[model samples]
Target: MKRNPMDFMPAYFTVAFVWFTTHFGGGFASGRQLVEFFVQYGWYALFTPVIAIAINALVFYYAWDFSVAHQKFQYRSWTDAFYKPYERVFSNLYDVVFNLVLVVATAVAFATGGATLADVLGTPYLLNTLVIAIIMFILTIYGANIVRAAASWIAVIVITGLLFIYGSNLVVTLPNLMTVLNEAPAPRGFWYALWQSIKYAGLQAALLGGYVAVTDVLKNKQDVKRAAICGFILNAGIMVLASAVVLSYYPTIISEAVPVVFIIRNGFGGVALELLVSLLIFLGVISTGVNLIYGGSKRIVSVWAKPEEGEKSIKNKRIIASGIYVFITWSIALMGLIPLVAIGYSYVAYLALPIVVIPVLYKGITKRGGEKGKSNELDAMTAADGPKA
Candidate 1:
């Protein structure tokens, strides 16, 4: 099963795009999260992405290495790898809380997509919601390969669109950028702001398991290494650019519901702005929703399937699970976007602090007591068997 890293080039790109799209959707693209988590910190906010990149990189690297070593592609196995005596407790907690967050977050994405399409096409919200739900459900049933491919390429298009929007806005704002930076206030100190930034990144806990679970596709440490680097750059690069644009218009657009849309309308205006903004929101919502559903189903099906189950049987279970998952998410999507994102996202960020950040980072850094040997065993297995786990 192990092959040349060159042979897995597509997987590398798929993982990178999946990681980017997973975090880059809904709250993130809406510029709502950017305003609250990044721009609100004033001049120090510039450093927020730096801290986030570091934390994301550290956590991602550990997850990738650990997953590959143990041949653990599911979230439960991942928890078992590190939690051990407390694996049952932590795994159960993570499975419940992480899925809850993902379902709500995916619903937020679905709701946003529906609203954006309805706004653009003058269609009814219900019709838009039904269509979006159907499309997402179809994508989920196709499972990981199709989802990853769609998300990866769609992410490229979205990011390119973002660069156009943010890049143009930044060019215009650069004239007044110095004044904005000087006048921006730090409501909290730099250290506190930095802590908030790290917490914001940790809110991504729901996506972490799936992100690392892609190790099932990878063939070598070099592939995982390159994938991590590419993923971090794609994600961090966008965050920095988007944060700077938000900061450029800080204080003024801070209170807007979707600050980035406001900036785009002001700069681009008319049909062009509408097309761009609609595309951004619609694509962002679908990409995140698909990744979340795909990820959760992967983990859930892994939990349900017997160890000796054949690939076809496991896939059949995924189809059933994905259908049920999509229905629940669609129901939640009816709650709408603003309330789901504004209220729900921040609390999840705080919860992730202890549940995901501390335990994973501690184990990854310390390598723990017996984990080194476990890692070696994994390396030996990989060496002998050629990455079939």
Candidate 2:
């Protein structure tokens, strides 16, 4: 029996959710990235996400090419194909950049958690972040897969909570948003907005590792295409709405460490919704931080620990590596969430542009978007053939 096209809709959505969840981590979930990249730029922020969408989707479409076509799912092997003959240098280079990405992303996660905790608990910012850091260290040193397994569902739940909160806020404050747009300053910030969007797109491109790492579920170019298109819609649409929510309050929203949290506490939603979302943000960032830290620790174990040495030695390296990252991220998180989003992510963008974005764009354009010109296994497989007992 031929499978209905809709029969595989869920699978395609799962892939799209992978991209969304990776992108929607601590920084995004906190609503800080929206403020930094779009809301701060004034009314033009309304349209900046479109520019960002183009840049991001362009990178995503081509970045997935080498991985999907060649069945390179692991980050290292995937990079081997993306950079091709020069994988020797560029792959090693990307490895460094990705580790740094892990660091910044985790640090941002801690910072986000701290901010959310402080808002809910009225604790000291430093103390909250430190506590969050310690918890992530303990959690990450133990395991990773369970959290990775939950990320997709986390995306769904957190996104639902955000949509309701932001959407309701939009409804309540629609007039405010409209007033801001109409009275939006005459300067019409253009170049600055686009530059921020570019920076944001480049910074996000750093996570191409996380995104492509899961493309194993995608069958072929068509699967990749639908997933990418779905990604663009989900990422951009939600971002635009979030930015509008922030813009409704304008410069006041600027002061918030976690704008969405601020909105909730300011009486946008009922107490129950606030608590649930708060818990979600707290768990969400911790999970995100732990997953990334554990990934980095495994990398260290692979490099410094020879499996033949003993299981204890390997486990020790893993623990030690987690501690090192925990300390570094603790220090970075001290700079607070805004600095992490504005400064830390900006640096990541600078690193990502040449290493991830430019190379892929070059490869994509020169190779005609990496068309295989023949049927591949991924494209030929039926839905039922993907998994075997």
TM-score against native, each model: 0.88, 0.82
lDDT per residue for candidate 2 within 239-298, as digits (tens), equals 888888888888788877788877766647867767776777776686667656665665
> By TM-score, who's the top model here?
1
Q: Stretches of candidate 1 above 4 Å error?
A: 1-10, 307-309, 369-389
lDDT of each: 0.72, 0.72
lDDT of model 2 at residue 232?
Answer: 89
Pairs that collide, model 2: none
Candidate 2 to truth, TM: 0.82
lDDT, candidate 2, residue 259?
83
